[model samples]
Target: MKIYTKKGDSGETSLFGGTRVPKSNERIEAYGTVDELNSFIGLAASYELSESGTKYLRKVQELLFTLGADLATPPSSQTRIDRISADDVSFLEDAIDTLEENLESLKNFVLPGGSQPGATLHIARTICRRAERATVKCANVDDISDNCIKFLNRLSDFLFVIARYENKHAGVREETWKGKQ
Candidate 1:
């Protein structure tokens, strides 16, 4: 199949159910941001410090792809195939819990840099938030599952914990914002 469909040249694109909307539609923006987050997750995964981290990141990447598919489909015609399961969100929660068990409890705001991999994870976390926001906006107009938003919210938390875990593993000290102290 040719990569260029030539159908979108007129500034419109088709949703999963064959519904055509403008290329600038909110649904397009929502899924596009999810796709962007997936790429950042791939970059972060490339620099993971441990086998477990790599595996978890791979799972997160797959979930983000599922989210992208969910967002790309028209809500009225969306199917089970496009929905992300609760299990996917629970997996992220489990990983976050496992990583947090080893880290010191947070008492202050964190500066978002550390080892190279940690910094990349932080970048991915921010992108995840943007994707979530975009998805929320789309949901306001379309029929999006609450679980979808919940998954994105938890995924951002998971990325933050993973970044801290990576920094701790790398012996990189987290620079706390001491403010006027």
Candidate 2:
């Protein structure tokens, strides 16, 4: 299929099942943020990462596509797509639990800078938050899956933990936020 369909020239796009809506539609905004998150994750993966980190990130990237599709396809649509589910959230939680086991317990807010990969992960975490908020807003009016919100929430936590793990593996010390004296 050609990339330039010119179908959206009028600022309208089609959902999965041929439902046309404005590009500024809430569902579009939510999945657009998700697509942005996926791009950042791809950038993070381009850096040097541990074997497990690389593996998990690859999986997360795949799931984000599913999430985007889920958000794009409303429940009323006939398109059957894989969607965010409880199991997906659990996967993130499990990964976070495993990675956090090697890190020191958190006693204060952690700063968002480290090695390149670690810093990129921190950036991705913030984008994840924005994506989650957009998804929440979309859910308020659309039939978005509850798991979509849950997955984004847990994914942010996963990104934070994985950032620390990446820094630890790279021998970079995590800087904690210190309030003004």
Candidate 3:
């Protein structure tokens, strides 16, 4: 299939149900940011210190693709394939719980830096927040699944924990935010 169909040349694109909307549509913005976050997650995964970290990141990337599919469909015409179910959010929560089990309790805010993978995970986490915010904005005008937003929220938290985990495993000390201490 040709990559350029010239269909979106007029600044409009089709949703999953063949409904066309402007490229600047909120749905597009939300899914686009999700795509961006997925890329950053891939980059972060490339530098992960543990096999489990890479595995989790790959799963998150897959979930982002699912979210993009969900956002790409008009609610009026959406089907099961376009639905990001609560099970998706539960998956993220489970992953978060597992990762948190291996992490130390947070005593204070952490400075975002340490090993290269840790820093990249921090960047990915911030991008995940942006994606989540964009999704929330889309939800204001559309029938977005609450699970989608919940998954993103938990995924960001998972990224933060994975960053600290990577740092700890790599023998990199986490820099705590000490307000002038």
Give the whole-model CA lDDT for all candidates, comma-separated.
Answer: 0.86, 0.94, 0.85
Q: Considering lDDT, where higher is better, how would the candidates rank from best to worst?
A: 2, 1, 3
- By summed lDDT, the worst window of 10 consecutive residues in model 2 runs over 75-84
TM-score (C-alpha, index-matched) for candidate 2: 0.98
22-96 in candidate 1: lDDT tens per residue? 989988998888888888878877774877788888888888888888887655674446578798889888899
Best by TM-score: 2
If both were scored by TM-score, which would come out higher, candidate 2 or candidate 3?
2
* Model 3 lDDT on a 0 to 1 scale: 0.85
**Candidate 1 runs further than 4 Å off:** 78-82
Order of quality (TM-score): 2, 1, 3
lDDT tens digits, residue span 91-127, model 3: 8778878878888898899999899989999999999
User: What is the model-wide C-alpha lDDT for candidate 1?
Assistant: 0.86
lDDT of 2 by residue, 38-119 (tens): 9999999999999989999999999999999999998777788998889999999999999999999999899998999999
TM-score of 1: 0.94
